[model samples]
Each structure stands twice: as structure tokens, then as C-alpha cells.
Target: MSQRVPNILLEQLSDFINKEMGLFFSKERKLDLLRGVSLAAEEFGFSDTEMCINWLLSSPLKKRQIEVLARYLTIGETYFFREARIIQALEREILPAIVEKRRNTSRMIRIWSAGCCSGEEPYSIAILLSRIIPDIESWKIVVLGTDINVDFLDKAQRGIYREWSFRNTPFWLREKYFIKTDDGAYEILPQIKRLVSFSYLNLVQQESPEYLNLQGFDIILCRNVLMYFSQPQVLSVINRFYQSLNDKGWLIVGSSEASHVLFPQFRTVNFPGAIVFQKDLSMEVSRAENVLFDMEIDDLIPATTTNYDFSALLNADNSIEEEAEDEDEFTKAVNFYEQGKYKLAAELFKTLLNDPVFADNPQVYILLAKSYANTGDLKHALHWCNKGVKKYRLEFQLYQLQAEIYQEMGKLDKALDALKNVIYLEPDSFAAYFIMGNLSKQLGKTKEAKKCFENAEKLLRLKERDDVLKEFDGITAGRMIHVIESMKSMESPG
Candidate 1:
């Protein structure tokens, strides 16, 4: 007979798990946690669930014990080609461009599948890569699959799967990449098997030195994982992901997890069938191509022009071409900003400000301010932001940018004023309220902070769960609500 866990003990265990592993269990999830704890007690040979919870709380858990707990608590609910559009985008668009770019270089491509369960996602990538690249033997390809669950990693290492894993996978893929086993399981072919490697990685616990030592990956897929983590943990992992990617590398999260708040640094690239974030390296080149393609030559020369000066026409064309080049330079500056080459970006942005065409562009001023701010030139950043506000008085983003600079400079009052301006301009601005909450908290005004957080949460709840919370850095609204609730809990008295 199994011993029952009390509600108090269950809450303690839930809190323990959340703090240690960064996995939150809501009121509804507490039952699931209790069930997992019961299973863990049985596995660890505890007499009762209370005894198991006491043991976990009293001392540091062993590696094996942690693995046993993970097996019970974490769900391994995934399939090969789970989101087919992402895979299709990789196959038809992303991989080909990467292949062509790296053809003359080292011809090396590295991909990471974070939280890979049962080895399906990474193997699918390997199989896809194999199909895309001709003369595959010449190129060095690496697909690393990592998960906290040792059981999942072990299964992934075996590279064998049942029919359920291929529920959404195309039929032709199985024929090409897998062999049927006598036990009715399918084993991945050696070709696909050799391309992938699996390892145990706790996303929350992994240090920068250990995980980011071998940076400059071509692509990273961390889908459906951040949804399980706390805001701070998710932010930490996303920052690491940003550092891990090479210039122009891609990061693909689950569709629901995409957020402007969480991924403010990444440039969102919308493909025909999918959207992926990129650490943009060649922004200028892409911008220039788009500009050229978009310009209508017929529009430039009026259809009624009977005796248009050929030299004037040529000069007009030359001006349009120069404008495109100037736009390209602006994009290059923005790219520099994204890459943390802020000093270089600031210089370029300043030079562009001298151009009459760009002088009045609010975006140019905003970028200049951001670049200065990033490089620790708060004085100049404030100056540019002020100038932007004077020129575009109603621009809410300018005020928001000013608030950020003020906050960075320790001008709390000024930051609050700027945030107020942002809120006044855009009443539904979740970011402004969130910032106000942080500012209030810093000043020890717990009540004000709590109210601000509540306001932000209410506004966020009104939006789609999957919509990137631009105010929170690209984290989803669902995740921000968790963050707010956590903050509210801390603010509450014992």
C-alpha cells in the first residue's frame, strides 16, 4: 500500500522542484507533481511520500536520484518532424542558403537540438541534412541533442523508435532513413545515426564556460522547452542561445514561445511558410537587394516624358541607387548594434545623420541613441533621444528608449517620467507597466510595484498567449504572467 502525501508536503515538494530545476507547477499541476513524487518515492525506496519529500529537502540529491526524479516529472511527449513547417523551411530554404554560403569555406555546419527527447528531432535534422547536401562525405556536419533527462538521452542514443514517433512524419522519410526491426521498432540508419550525438544538459544549471565554450553554431532549435521554465531561467537560457549562435545563425523556438520581449536582439525573418529569428550578420546585403528589387524603373521615368534629358534620367537613376546603398549602410549599422559592435554602429549612424535624406528619419535617431547607450555613452544617448523626441514628439518608442537610457544612468525619476509618457501615449503598453513595476520595486514601493505588475499582467492576458511580449524582451505573455505571479508571491507577507 502507498502512503498518501498531504497538501502541505505537496506544496513544499512543488516549491523545491521549481527552485532547484526552474520548473513551475501551478495549482492544476500540483496533482501531477504529487503523482510524480509518489513514483519517485517508489523508485528511490522511500517508505512513504512524506519521507521522500523530507529526504529531498534535507540534503543534496545524487546524480542517479536526480535522474530518477526527472524520469517521473518530465514528459517525453514529442515526435519526429513534429512541426513539419519548421522542418520544411529548414529543408527548402535555410539549409540550402547555409550550404551555398559555406561551400567555399570550411564547409562545416553545427546544429543543436535543446531538450531533444527520444532523439527524434536531431535525427530528423541529420536525415534532412543528408538529403540536402551532395558529396556529404566532404563536409563536417554536427547535430548535438541535449536534454536534462538521462532516460531520454539514453533512448535517443539508441536511435530506435516506434510508429507513434512517426505519426506526422512523411512516409517516404522512413523508407529512406530507417530500417524496420524484428520487434516492430524502426532503427535509424548508420548514415543518419553517425551525424548526431546526445548528451545530458540541464539548461538552467549549465554554465556559460561549459556550454558556450564552443560557440558559433549555425542553427539552434530549442522548441517547447522554455515554456516549462521561469522567466529568469528562460531569459538566462535565451541570452546563452544568443551568445552561442554565429553571426547570421538562426534560432527556432516553438511557435507559441516566440516573443519580441524575450528576443529583442534577434531580427525576425518571415519566410513564406514559417518565421524564424536570426542573429543577423549580413543585414546590409539583404536590405540592399530588397530595395533594388522593390524600386520601379517605370515609375522613376514618367510615361508621358517625350524628351526627358537622358543625363537627368541617368542622374535620377544614380540617386535612387545611392539611396539604396545608404539604406544598406543603415542596415549595416543596425546589424552592428545587434552584434554588440555598438561603437562602430554609433559612428556609422552619426555619419548617416549628416545625409539630408536620413536626417529626419526617427528610426535613424533611435538607432543612434540605442547604439550610444549600448556603448556606455549615456550622455550622447540621452542627447540623441531628446533630439528624437523634439522632432517626433508623439513617438512613444522614443520615450521608451529614453526611459531605458535613464534607467541605465541611474536617473530613476527621469526613467519614471519617461515611462509615464510612454503609458500616456500608448495606454496598453505592457512594457511600460512592467518597467514601472521594476522601478517601483527598486524604490521599495512594494504596493506600487504590485499594482504595476497586475496592470501589466491584465494587459498581457488580453493578448494572444503566443504573441511575443515586446515589453518583456520577446517572452510570451503566458510566461510573463508566471513572472508576475512569482513577483506577487514574493511581495506577499509570510
Candidate 2:
């Protein structure tokens, strides 16, 4: 007979994972991994490995199942033009200069969409460049979109999407670019296809990132892509990005990912709800320029002014005036919130709650609620959730939070009720529908539950983009399929 795994082995495994992945799972967190392990055991017909993982992550370890679960659960459903604000800034500030910098020289502006799931993000940037840069006819542009999932890359190269992918995209551009087929699908045009290139890139794979041969990209967009990684992984990727860029090149990331870059080599360019960073190029210029690099984090705050002298860090040969532009204080708060410092983020947001400009803004409240929720303060989280809903009854995000919070509290009925409101406000929220269906099944609400599962399946199928997210879709379909089959079996008159 095989010897059972020891408690010490499990503890060591959990410790290694915590150090490597930044996901804590002591003896208390065993249950967190239990459901997943249980499911695996039911399939595998043996509980040793799964049991070891479960025991390692149980209550004695810490209730870290959800955090551990994040590594597997979320889908990286990114496309080009993921964030409008950064895209706008790219058009206004970065692209123009990049084009000019390459004007007389190689005259080529190279860009990469690292971890691009399907072709959406790279194509979006390429299309924007084509629209903004006047000499696109003569200028050379290289855009590469890459992903680890070969299936996803294949879908990206094919360039077809169902309606959901274009939910936020402007329709007029759709007509100008994509050709609609008789069966209600859109295909990207050859011209736009020619603008970008595609390949496979598994971020955490042991192999090096694809396209190691290429260098000096004018812009690199790895937005919404970094937070999924362990800190060391992110640090490695960020360093690669720093090396890959030419001097003064820009890095556009997700609105929430600013804290991932605290290195002195990059300086932040803050916008209202977004910020981008550029490579700091002045250390080689003068000894006086080195002073900006040495400024301690403690000196970052100017108690009286509430602003940092950002230009001192930049290299501008021109002697100019010192005038602050139309800068928003809220962006700084958004940056904090994105970095997972929920307590500090909540505190920063609380101070801004009194400002009339944000007094009635539902979004600010929603952000505050998310911050509170992240910190494990369910009561305060729900309080802010209700506050957001009172004024902005139609905001679906708050409803999603309430559903999650209620579900966590084991108030299944209340969670479903909250989700029902979400459906009423926004009929197309696949997330809310999926949760509703899952919760309905969990609560044993048979007939109504079957309807929700069917609805979720329909919505997800409707939104499927060339099966680009087939694996992601498959997992959801698998969960729903079992419930749906159970309902069918229950309904049969035996």
C-alpha cells in the first residue's frame, strides 16, 4: 500500500507556493482548495494529491481558497483599445512623437501587445495609428499580438467576433473597418489585418517570451495583464519591458496597475483616471538630473501643494514655464485602489467623498465599496454598496458586489434578489447571469433555476468570439452543463 502524504509535505508545498505565487495557504485554508480538489478527486478516483492540497489549505491554514482560486478562475478577455483613456492619450501624446522619432531614421514604429488574448488590442492600436499618423502610407509600422494559448492565438489570427466583443466599441468604426456577414458576424478587413502580426506567448511558461529577436519597440501595452502574475513574475516582465523599449518609450498598462512599477528607472505620467510611465532617460545627462532620481518616497508628498514637480524628472532641452495642467486628484486614488492596497485606497477615497464633484458620483462610491470588500470588511463594504445603489440604482457593478457579498455571507436568497435587480438594470451582464444561475442551483430553486442556467448558457454562447475563449467557455459550460443535466434528470417522469 502507498504511504499517505505527510502533513509536513503539504505545509512545505503551501509555503513554497506562498513564496512563489504570493497566495497564502496555511493549514486554515485547506477548505479553500477543498472543493476544487474534491471535484478533481471525483474525476481522478483518488484523493491523495488533492487531499494533501486540501489539508494544506484548510481552516487551520487560512481561508485563502478564493485568493488561490483567482489563479484559475478569471479570463484575460483583452482586446486592443481595452481602455479608451490610454488610447486617447496614445493618440494625443505618444504616437505622434514616436512617429516623428522614426521619421528620418528607420521610419518604423514597432509595437507589441504582450499577452494579447486575441487580436483585439493590437489591431485597435494599429487602427488608431493608421487613423492619427498622416504619413502611414510611407511610414513602416510593425505591430505584434501574442498569447500563450495556441487556440486563442488561432482565433486572434482569424479575426472574427460575436456581438459581445464590440459592446464598448464605436459602431461607426465597425462599419468603416469590418464587413458584416449575412449570419450576423463581423470579420476584420485585410488592411487592418496587415497592420498587425500574431504569435503565441505564454507569460509564465519556462520558455522565453516569443519575439526575443525583436527590440526597440516604440510602445508596449501589457495592460490588465500584469496583476494575474506573482510579484517576481511581474518584476521580471516589467524589467523585460524596460529593456525592450527604446529610450523615452512609453508603457501603457491597465488603469489599476500603476503600483507594479515603483522602479526609479520609470517616471509616472498621471492622467485623470489613468496614467502611463516613460523610461527615465536623464541620469546620463547631468549630475543635477541625478537629484530627481534620489528623491526618497517620504519626500513624495508636498503637504502644502498636493502635487509633485514631475518635469524635473523629464529631459526637455527647451527652457519653459512651470504651469500645472488640468490635473485631477482622483487619479492618484485610482492608482492606489488598483495596487491592492485597499485600506490606504479606502482612506484616500473617504477624504474625497466630501468633494461636491464626487459627492453624487456613483462610480466613486462603487470603487470605495470594492476597496472595502478587498480588505475583508463586509459590513462597511455593504454600507458603501447600498450608498452607491441609492443614488445610482441602475449601476450594475454595485449589484454584482452586493450579490457576491450576500453570497459570501450565506444569504443566498438576498444574493439572488440583488442579482435580479442587476438583470433588470442591465440585461446583458453575463457575469450577473452566470452567478444567478450558479446560486439558483446552489439554493435548490429548481424550476426558476433551470431558466437562469439556460439563460446564462444562451448569453455566453451568444457572446462567444470564434470560440477564442473555448477553454474559458468550456469550464463555464462544464459547470452549467452538469446543473442543467441534473435539472433535466429531475424533471423526467420516471
**Each candidate's TM vs. the true structure?**
0.58, 0.49
Sliding window of 10 residues with minimal summed lDDT for model 2: 300-309
Over 1-494, each residue of candidate 1 has an lDDT whose tens digit, in order, gives: 25577788788877778767767776646777888888888888886888889899886565676678899988776778656446656876899999999999999999999989789989988977887887888999999998878989999999989998876455566777889999999999998899999877777775523375547799999986776775556766776887789998999987546543456567877542245889975454334323433322111111110110112111221112222455577777766654445698789999998888788789898888877765567899899999999999899989988887787677877888888898999999877887787777666776877788789889988988666543332346766666565555544334
**Residue lDDT tens for model 2, 1-494:** 12244667556655544443333343534444344444434434554664545554444322243223333422446543455546556765688777777778887888988878767888888777877776787877899886654556677889887776675455555776788988898888888788888875555443343546547987888865654454345555666787788888878765434532233467777542346878767644244235443432212111111111122111121112232455565765665665445687788788788998877777788778777766668799889888888888888777877876776567889989998998998897655665666566566676775687577667766653334322121223333332233334334333
Deviating ranges (above 4 Å) for candidate 2: 1-74, 205-211, 284-494
- How high is the lDDT of residue 449 in model 2? 59
User: What are the Cα lDDT values of the candidates?
Assistant: 0.73, 0.60
Estimate the TM-score for candidate 1.
Answer: 0.58
